[model samples]
Target: MTLKSFSGVALAALAVTFLSAASAQANDISKCVLSGEKGSVAITPVNEGAITVETALPNPAWWNGDTPDQIADGYEYCLAANIAHRAGFDKVNLVVSSFPALIANANQNKDLAMATISITDERKKVLSFSAPYFSSDIGVMVKAGTKVDAETVKTFRIGVLQGTTGAKFVSERIKPAEEKVYAENPAMFAALMAGQIDAAITDTAIILGQAAKSNGALTVAAQYQTGEFYGAIYPKESPNKEAMDKIIDDMRADGTLAKLASTYLADSWGADPTKVPYLKP
Candidate 1:
């Protein structure tokens, strides 16, 4: 072949190889965005606790009703699924283990834990946390007309979601004589309605949502300034931890987080992104 023709052909081959490499890189990112191709992420409830996750349901059309599946489709589950999908995971799996089990599994397997875990300095020592997805304060829910002040409510049988910061707060701060920890918030609320528990302590947003749906059956006794910051928990040494943090930060900057919060937390919960408090490290 002529020397000029040979040179042209070699250049073309080089160009093709470069293009192929670029395309492959782009595909990897796309796969990460679509299927979280690294692996399947598992999120379980808090240790013995039953608070629903923001990612419980991939869709919100079926959030009413008293079934586990229905509750799963409610706000927390849906929110988690939405964020997972947006962050490039093909499918985010929600596991139904207790909160403690979830934490233990994450520690062992290094999977992401998405149950509504509140970020605390003590927990940060054990695991990594994503940016605050939701901000909540501790609140008390009692039967309508229950004559109890916030101080007296601490002495009564206080129901809490098992393995939650609320439960921990009650244990360390309130130290109630009889504390009932349920696997799920709905169960705790049910116990209050049944008179099995005097009052339920939980995130103000969840309790307010429950109260709004209950038609005056329950009332908020008092809302405390516990300053709870709910976050997506991950194993302490997760490789994807930085990536997940970047995605959450990007979402916050781009207003996606605010939009999701508004959809799930309701207007009354005050979904303003600017108003959301960040957890101090």
Candidate 2:
């Protein structure tokens, strides 16, 4: 064959070899797959591996680009994808479910679960967690025209995720007229937008992204420093915990995690972590 033709053929062959290897890896992941709860859906993974990691939404499915049976593009999702890719996992599965559901089925047929889930003493009993990849203060969302000074938030109808740090903060500190628990990020934000709730408390990134996306319809009324960090969840006694923890440690040492944070979150996403303005009623 001609030299140029030979080169082209070689490149094509290399591409085919890569595809074949990738296909083989996917089959490997499927071979080891465990059956998940009824709601979970298989995803076309960025990498192929022996175990399937499951995920709910990024809370804000809008920000994360998560849909049923599709891999999400949110920062948390990206973080999981990166870690799995780094750890030599060839495939991952995505599901859009509430945290309650995700937590309920943690190890049924899934290897890992993520959705900006915070590491907590309570959660440790049921699920193992990798080292922290992200830390943030909680933020409260409110309408653009509302007054949120130190005291005005009490007049605002407030809500938080059912079992989150934000919920703890609201229950113990805010003690609203009637504390509302939302199922997911979008629902909380929707309540705020529709005037159903005057405010919703969530992670800093959610506040930041919502405020930016709302076009002056929503604003971050307040931020509370909860000293919280996000971690990916694994089944209790997960075999991958040690390797995943080491991978996170190495990523931190190499600045991979910070780079990811900046790429996904603004540079100053959580600049302050000590603002406590909630008042117990």
Candidate 3:
């Protein structure tokens, strides 16, 4: 072959290789992005390779296990895993973080945290919330054979989880004769069963699940229509908020969220939250 022809063929091969690599890179970027209200945004992992997801643990049905690695089951775990996958991360780095700590500290450094956090205007001041993934209402649970209602609850010893809407409700609206704040669900439930607290108030799904596991030792007394929705929380003004919101919306639209709820929550919650009687609080 002539020297000129050989040079032309070599250059053509080099151009083809460059175009192929560029196309592959473009496809990869497309896979890494999520588009929503703001526009397309790329999800960058907060941790090295895996997406960091913080959750309050030992929450039966929602987060069944006690530690980070053991939290391989339940609704929130399943949802978190799905979120990581959609974000183009191969795995999720689950970390144990308290519910209050996550809310109070705006610079927690985690990519996302899910602790059944209710989206409230007051909380939005310090944190950015992804679009709501689940909704719940205020619930009242009492020891078996104990009687309590909206009005009567004002006189009972009430137990609430600190830094939660339940605590806010009891303090602001209920004005109960006595109120106790516990850091976590197990502690609060222990106080109720031991008679240290006359009743416990929190999200309907949570108390109902606890009550179901109690096997007649406890019962849900009343529920209020607070119309609260749970969202995945992000650090204040985090750039990834829009991307996570878009991912959640897509999951909802494609019925992925529904499937996860059905698989993990159906048996764990044990009772239908919608059927719980609503009381005026």
Residue 150 in candidate 1, Cα distance off native in Å: 3.3
Q: Write the per-residue lDDT of candidate 2 for residues 243-274, one digit (tens) a residue.
A: 66776666555444544454445422322222
TM-score-based ranking, best first?
3, 2, 1
Candidate 3 C-alpha lDDT tens digits along 146-228: 87766888899999998998899889988899999999889999999899999999988688889998989998878886656
TM-score to native of every candidate shown: 0.65, 0.73, 0.82
lDDT of 1 by residue, 1-281 (tens): 33334222221122222112322122221122121222223333233212223232112221333433435333444444444554444343445555566655444442466655678888778767776655556777789898766457656998998777888888887777698888766678779999999989876656766766678888765766565566777655666666566655554444444444444445433222222232211
Highest lDDT among the candidates is held by which one?
Answer: 3
For residue 183, what is the lDDT in candidate 1? 76
**Which one wins by TM-score: 1 or 3?**
3
True-structure RMSD, every candidate? 15.7, 13.2, 15.7
After superposition, the stretches of candidate 2 with alpha carbons farther than 4 Å from their true spots are 1-51, 58-63, 68-72, 105-107, 267-281
**Lowest-lDDT window of 10 residues in candidate 3?**
27-36
Output the better candidate (2/3) by lDDT: 3
